[model samples]
Target: MLQSPVEFFRTLPKKVCPECGEHIQEQAESYLFECERCLANKEE
Candidate 1:
């Protein structure tokens, strides 16, 4: 069976930041999964 890209993504669970438990808004292609705030903090 084949699934459309949109359908495949919709079936996946939402991503959350491991550090803060905040919902992640990054795209699926993002190499890092952390949310923006956590990523910024880690870079400091």
Candidate 2:
């Protein structure tokens, strides 16, 4: 089954981090995603 780009995005779960409950930032042309703050904290 094939789906349009708009429909694909519409079906995606809310862009949010499971760690800190912050909204995840959108990354263009990327399949993996994470909240900016949580990612930064992980580097510390």
Candidate 3:
């Protein structure tokens, strides 16, 4: 029996990295996402 990748990822929970403060979605999205700290640094 084979497990579907979609099914596997769907079961995972979203996590936010304290160091970066970015929300990591269980499923990937099209748009690029960055942490607030990273974004602020980019403006500098």
Candidate 4:
């Protein structure tokens, strides 16, 4: 049985920070992507 694209993504792994190597939690309510690692690295 074939699943929908949305369903496929729901089962797929979530995005993570390439710098600190932390998971990037999704915040659909707000139109923003907050990356702790990237933010910290940017300050350096």
Candidate 5:
């Protein structure tokens, strides 16, 4: 059986940060940063 959006998001895999070794949550948006600190540091 297929899972719902809520279930999918709940079971989403997090990505690791290469710079500071942080786990980033899966976001619905396409253009996302690996970590908040990285994004704030202009890693985009």
Candidate 6:
């Protein structure tokens, strides 16, 4: 189990949003691998 917040974050695969330069958390592949905001707009 994770021992702290820093350790938890260190385990995640985070990257900058290609469109907006915002930090994005990498989620599961089935979740679409996109910027949260961009993905929302794309669905609209």
Question: Quick one: RMSD of model 5?
Answer: 3.6
Q: Can you write out model 4's per-residue Cα lDDT over 14-42, one digit (the tens) per residue?
A: 77766666778877664424476688668
For all candidates, the clash counts are: 0, 0, 0, 0, 0, 0
What candidate 6 gets wrong by more than 4 Å, as runs, is 1-14, 27-33
TM-score quality measure for candidate 4: 0.54
Ranking by lDDT: 1, 2, 5, 4, 6, 3
lDDT (Cα, tens digit) per residue for candidate 5, span 1-44: 99999999778677787778898765666555558888788755
Q: Write the per-residue lDDT of candidate 1 for residues 11-38, one digit (tens) a residue.
A: 9888788899988876646867788888
Query: Global lDDT for candidate 1?
Result: 0.83
Most TM-score-accurate candidate: 1
Model 6 superposed RMSD (Cα) = 5.7
For model 4, the stretches where C-alpha displacement exceeds 4 angstroms are: 29-34
The number of the candidate with the highest lDDT is: 1
* Cα misplacement distance, residue 17 of candidate 5 (Å): 1.0
Q: Is candidate 2 or candidate 6 better by TM-score?
A: 2
Estimate every model's Cα lDDT from 0 to 1. Answer: 0.83, 0.77, 0.65, 0.72, 0.75, 0.72
Model 4 poorest ten-residue lDDT run? 28-37
Candidate 2, residues 1-44: lDDT per residue as tens digits? 89999999889987777787777667787554667777788899
Pairs clashing within candidate 2: none
TM-score of each candidate structure, all chains considered together: 0.62, 0.52, 0.34, 0.54, 0.46, 0.46
Q: RMSD for each model, in Å, please?
A: 2.4, 2.9, 4.0, 3.3, 3.6, 5.7
- Candidate 3: stretches off by over 4 Å: 20-34, 37-44
